[model samples]
Target: VTAISGSNVSLQISNLSTNYEQLTWLYSAHQKILEWEFNKTNLFKSKFKNRVSLSGNQALSIFNVQKEDSSTYILRVLKESGKEEEWHISLEVFDPVPQPNIEIQKKQEVNNICHLQLSCKIPDQSITYTWYGNSRALAAGPQSFMLEITVNSENHSTSYTCEVSNPVSSKNDTVYFTLPCQLGKKYSWGWEGGHRVDEVKKDVGIL
Candidate 1:
């Protein structure tokens, strides 16, 4: 099972019979997390402290989970008939995805074709990025963070979205190309004439 960091997660032992004499939960097969002696007392590990709990239905819950809590857990039940049953569960914890930012790295018009280079501004290399145009997926691969595309000047007024995701969460941001890519049009970002400028009008002969 996969869980987001700082969230609560529960691992349940389903169809547990009532004829069990003792119930125990182990971490990584050796470390005992908790044990319940039937009708007697419950013992919990000091490491877990107040962060872990066992429900009446034999569910193990952890609050405010962290990446360090990801591991394999085993639930062992000692039946009254001298037989033992076990259930194994694996948990994976991942950090929540941050909201993505789309940046125009380069944009220029040549011969009526608008060339654009975009990037998803996320520093994490473990995350995957996907590009979309007008709500449709682009040709960029699932793991690509940079996207380059060309559009006719007449059809350049569209929106492009960048989605960044991990195993547990996803976030996306969009950039709108509402202004025409005509000569002398003003742009707030991207390169012009091999120099970086902001909120400037394009020159008639610059690319």
Candidate 2:
């Protein structure tokens, strides 16, 4: 069916019989061919000599698979009693997922609870989304494209990240939320040269 790049994959044959006169492998897409008989295999096409192989059970093994290797493969077994059997297998390869974009659609505070909503901008429906809070994984599943979280004053200065991924690759983006900073002021008096008094002011910011 499907395989990613740089991975090894094999196509297996069932009901194998040792009485076969010869086993042949034909790559329908590139016109590459191979034949095995009497424990000896004849390989054609130098391009596939190192990556393609036929096992003892007539299985095809492809090593260090690449995107260009996506094609249909056919295996033909010639029996000693003058009968032939064939197997067809299709392979597909995909690239890694790219970085994702996140949007903060809405944020509102009701009573003492803040409601935050977010969405992923990617259009691929097959991709899955996972939510994390301060590097801790949330209870999320594959269908959670949109997220709704409720935060209170206890959760101020928090961070949330969304990891979008598929079977081959993953990417993520993060957002931070901060509470309103508290400002304070203090006033003090200093004596001038025994006649007048000067005033000084100080301001402080606390989170």
Which candidate comes out best when scored by lDDT? 1
lDDT for each residue of candidate 1 in 113-186, tens digit (9 for 90 to 100): 78888787677766777877777888545568888888895666466777777777766666666543432222
Error of 2 at 117 (Å): 8.7
State candidate 1's TM-score.
Answer: 0.77
TM-scores for all candidates: the values are 0.77, 0.56
Off by over 4 Å in 2: 99-161, 179-207
The residue pairs in collision within model 2 are none
Cα error, residue 56 of model 1, in Å, equals: 0.7
Local accuracy of candidate 2 as per-residue lDDT tens digits, 37-156 = 888998887566888888766788888887788788888889999899877888875545555555667777788777777776567665678877767877466788677877788874
* Runs in model 1 lying further than 4 Å from the true structure: 40-46, 139-142, 154-157, 179-207
Cα lDDT, model 1, residue 146: 89
Clash number for each model? 0, 0
User: Where's the lowest-lDDT run of ten residues in candidate 2?
Assistant: 187-196
